[model samples]
Target: MTSESSPTIGLPAGDDVFPVLPLRDIVVFPHMIVPLFVGREKSIRALEEVMRADKQILLATQQNPSEDEPTPESIFTVGTLASVLQLLKLPDGTVKVLVEGVSRAEILRYTANENYYEAHARRIADNVGDQVEVEALARSVVAEFENYVKLNKKISPEVVGAVTQLDDYSKVADTVASHLAIKIPEKQAILALPTVVERLERVLGMMESEISVLQVEKRIRSRVKRQMEKTQREYYLNEQMKAIQKELGDSEDGKDELAELEEKINKTKLSKEAREKAQNELKKLRQMSPMSAEATVVRNYLDWLLGIPWGKKSKVRNDLNYAQEVLDADHFGLEKVKDRIVEYLAVQSRASKIRGPILCLVGPPGVGKTSLGKSIAKATGREFVRMSLGGVRDEAEIRGHRRTYIGSMPGKVIQSMRKAKKSNPLFLLDEIDKLGMDFRGDPSSALLEVLDPEQNQSFNDHYLEVDYDLSSVMFVTTANTLNIPPPLMDRMEIIRIAGYTEDEKSDTSRLYLVPNILMEHALEAKEFSVDDEALKTVIRRYTREAGVRNLERELATLARKSVKELILAKKKSIKVSPKNLEDFLG
Candidate 1:
C-alpha cells in the first residue's frame, strides 16, 4: 500500500508475528488509514513495541470498549494488519500515531507477552472474481455513498474525492466502508467479508439505511427551525407593542391585581414557614408573563396558600351538661353513645390540648349514627360536614390525588375542612363498613393516619403537599356492622348502639318522633292526639323494626289520615284508639 508523508510499507510475509493493539468503537479496513490515541498502559506498550520492531501491528477491535485490558479471545479474530506511518507523544502522557491498513489477517494464536498481547497472524488476500461484476457492485456503492454525503454534510468532501479516484474494486469498497457513519459491528462485518463483491454489497445496504435516517433527521431539524422563527417573530412583536403602550401610559399589566394579592398575603395570619414559601412563589409569579404555563401553576399554588385557614381554629364548647342536653335533644334512645360523647367532652374541658378520640358508631340503619355527628358538632359549637364513604375504593379519594394528575383536587378529609371553612370541624365518615377495594388502592388503609390523633396533627394530603392540622378536629365514623378492616378498627373507639326495646320505642314516639311527624304533616297538635294504646298497637301489628323509623312513618300516616277528616268534615278534636286505629291506619 502507498503511504502519505511516511515511507511505504508492504504486507507481512509467511507466518507474521505482530504486537496486538485492540481498538474500541472503530473498525480498521484494508487500504483505510486512521489515527489512534493510545491511553491504556498495555496498548501503549504494544504500540511502542511495534514501532521498534517491524513498525507493523495487529490492529483489532475489542468486543467491549470498557475492558481496559482485554484477553486475546475478547478481540475479533479477523483484523487489519496496519503499519505505523507516524508517531507523536502528547503532553498528557499519551501517544498518537497514524497507521494504514495493509491487508486482512487472521490470528492463529496469542504469544505470551508480559506487558501486552502479541499474536501470530496469517494474511488473507481478497479473492477477486469476475472483473465486470466487481466493477458493477463498486459503482452502485459509490453512487449511494455520494447521495448519503449530500444529505449529511458533516462528512468531509475529501472522502468522496478519495473514493472516486480509486479504481481497484477491493480498495474502493474498503475506502467507502470505513468513511460511512456506521457502528463498529457493521464495519467489522464488512472487514470480515472474504471477497470484494461481498464487502461492496454490504456497504451499499448500510449506506442506504444511513441515508434514510439522515433524511428523517433533516425533516425534524427543519420543523424545529420553523417553530423557532415563528416564536422569535411573535416575541419581538409583543415586546414592541408593550413598549408603545407603556409610552402612551395605557399599560395595566396586572399591576392592580398583583398589588391586591400582595396586600392580602401580608395581612393574613399564616405560619412563618408557610408565609415565606408563599412570598417566594409570589416573587416567581411576578417575574413570569401571564401567558406562560408556569404562571398558572404559580397562581394555583398561591391560591391554596391564601385559601387555607392556616392558624384559624373553631371555638369548642366543653360544657358537659350542655353537651348531654344536645345529645338527648337531637337523638332518642342512645344513652350509651351519649355517655361516651359526654366523657370525651369532660376530658376535653379539663385539658385544652387533649385530642379527641376517633369514635365510630356501630348500629342498624335509622338508629341515628349519622345524626350523632351533627349533635356533637352543635354541642361543641363547631362546623359540621359529613362524607358518606360507602363505596370508596381508592386511597387517593381520602388522601387526595397528586397535583400531577389532571382534575386532581383535595381529598374528602381536606374537602370537608374547606366546606366547613375551619381547620377544626366535625367530620362524619358515614358507612365505613361499606367501603370497597379495587386495583386503584385500598381506601381503608388511608384512614390509619387520619384516625390517629398524633399523626393526624401532621396529615399531609398528596394534592396539598402540606401538613394540615387535624388534631383538634373531631372525626366521628359510622357503620352498620363490624366488617371494617382490623388496622382501621384498631385506631377508633367503637361504640355499639343497640336497637331500642318495645317500651323505649313507645316513649320515643311520644316524646320526639310523634311531635316531629305531627308538625311535618301540617296537622294541628291540639286537634289530634295519638294515644299510647294506639301507638303500641301500630308497633305490634302495623310495623316491626329495630329503630323508630317505621314507628315515625306510621305516626305521619295517622296525622295525614286525621287531616283528611279535619279538612272534609271540620272535625277539630279526634283521638286515635287501638280499636279504631285500623280504620285510620288501613
Candidate 2:
C-alpha cells in the first residue's frame, strides 16, 4: 500500500507488459531492495530481457514452493513490479540481480514466448484516505511497532527512524509491514490490499500474535538463566564449606579410618618383611589426598593386610583315635583313603614347622576323594574350602590377577585363608587334572608354588605383591586321572580312589545314600524303607558307574515315586522291593 505520489521509476504505465519471474515462498513488497539468484531458464531469461529493456520485471510468488515447474495457475495473479538495480553474471550460468520492488501490479493477461515469460500487468496505486485520519493512524502504527521491536531484540532500532521519516501514511504502513515477522502468505495478503488502512490493520493483528510468542520464549530463556546461576552459586558455596571444614580439621575424609587400620596392623604379630611392606604402604596412603583414586587403592590394599590372620592357627586334635573315628563315621569304604588322612593328622600334631606333603587323591568321579578332604577338616579341627580347577586357563586364577587390572583379586589360596579367618585350613583343589591352558596362561604351572611345601612357605601372588605364608595350609587335591603335569605331581603324595565293587556300592547305598534320600523327600524312615535286595538290584541293573553318585540318584528316584504312590493310594506305609521297584521308578 505505497503512495502513488512517489515516483515508480522503471515501472510500465497502465497495462504495459514486462518479463515475469516466479518467486518461491518470498513476498517482495514495494520499497524493498533484495538480491536474488536467478537459476531457472525462464527466470534467468526474464532477468536478461528486463536488463535489456527498462530493467523492469513482474515478480510473482508460487502457491506451492515444492513444485519444480509452476504453471500460471500455481502463482498468484497479484505481484510486484521490480526494477533491476545491479546485474552480475555468475560462473554457473546463473545471473545474480539486485532488484527493488517499485509498486504492486495485477496480471491482466500473459504473453506466450519461448525465450522468457511475458505478462501484461497493470500498476496498482494506494487508495488515499482523509489527511487527519491517515496522520492519526500512522502515529498508532509507529507506537505498536516500537512495542514489537522491544519484544524482538533482533529487529534493528533504525526501523523506528525510517518509519518516522516517511511523510506518506501508505508508505509508512507498507514499510513496517514488510519488516514485520510473519508467514509469507500473510505478508502477501497485506501487499495485495488496495488501501493503507486495511494493510495496517492486518499487520497490527499479526504483530500482536508475534509479540505473544516472543514474550513466552523470552520468559523461558530468562528462567533457565536464573536457574543456572542459582546452581553455580550453590556449587561454589558447598566447595567453600568443604575447604573451611578441612582447614578446621573437622572432616573425617578417610584420615581417621586410615589411622585405625594402621593401629590394628601394628598390634598384630606379622613377619618382619610383611610388617615393613604394610608400614610402607601406610606411609604412601598418608601422603595422598583422601579423595584421589590412588588413595582408594592404598586403602583397599591396607584392608587386605588387616584382614589376614597374621599369627592365629587352628587347634589341631593330637588324638589319633578321635581322628580315625571321625573318618569312619563320615564316609564308608575307602579305608585306605581314610587311613592316609589320619596318618597325616597324627604327623601334623607331632611336628612344629613341618613341611607336609600335598595329598592328591586321583580317582574316578564321586568316589569319596572330596569327602575325604572334609573328613580331614573335621579330624584336624580346621575349616574346609573347595576350589574347582576345571577349565581354568588363566594363571591369574591360580596366582592372582595383577592389581593394575580391573576387578583384580587374590588367588584361591589367599581367598580361602581370608575366609577361614585362620592361618591353616584344609583347602581341597577339586578336579586338578582337568585344568586347561590357553593364551591367558597355564593354571597348572602356577599351582606348582602353591602345592610345593618348600616354595609355598612364602607364596607370592601377583595381586598381593607380597609373600603369603602357605606352609600351614593343608592342601588336598582331587582328580579323576593320574595324567597331570610332572612338576605338579612331584609335590603331591598321590593316593588312588578306585571304582567301587558291587558289594561296596550295596553297603554305601544302605548306610549313606538311603537315609539321605529319605531326608530329601521329607519322609519318615518308619513310613518308607529300602531293603538290601532292592539296593543290589539298583546297583546291578539301573546304575553302572565307578562311584556311588549314580546309585544315589537311583535311590532318590525310587523314593520319590514310592512317596507319590503312598499319597495317592492313601496308604499308611510302603516297602521298596526289587519286583515292585519298576512300578515306583517308572
Q: Which candidate is the best by TM-score?
A: 2
The sequence of per-residue lDDT tens digits that candidate 2 reaches over residues 554-585 is 88888887788789989888898887887866
Residue-level lDDT of model 1, residues 34-80, one tens digit each, is 88998888888998888787668988999988988787889999999
Model 2 ranges off by over 4 Å:
1-253
In candidate 2, what residue range of length 10 has the lowest lDDT sum? 1-10
lDDT of each: 0.82, 0.82
How many pairs of residues collide in each model?
Answer: 0, 0
lDDT (Cα) of model 2: 0.82
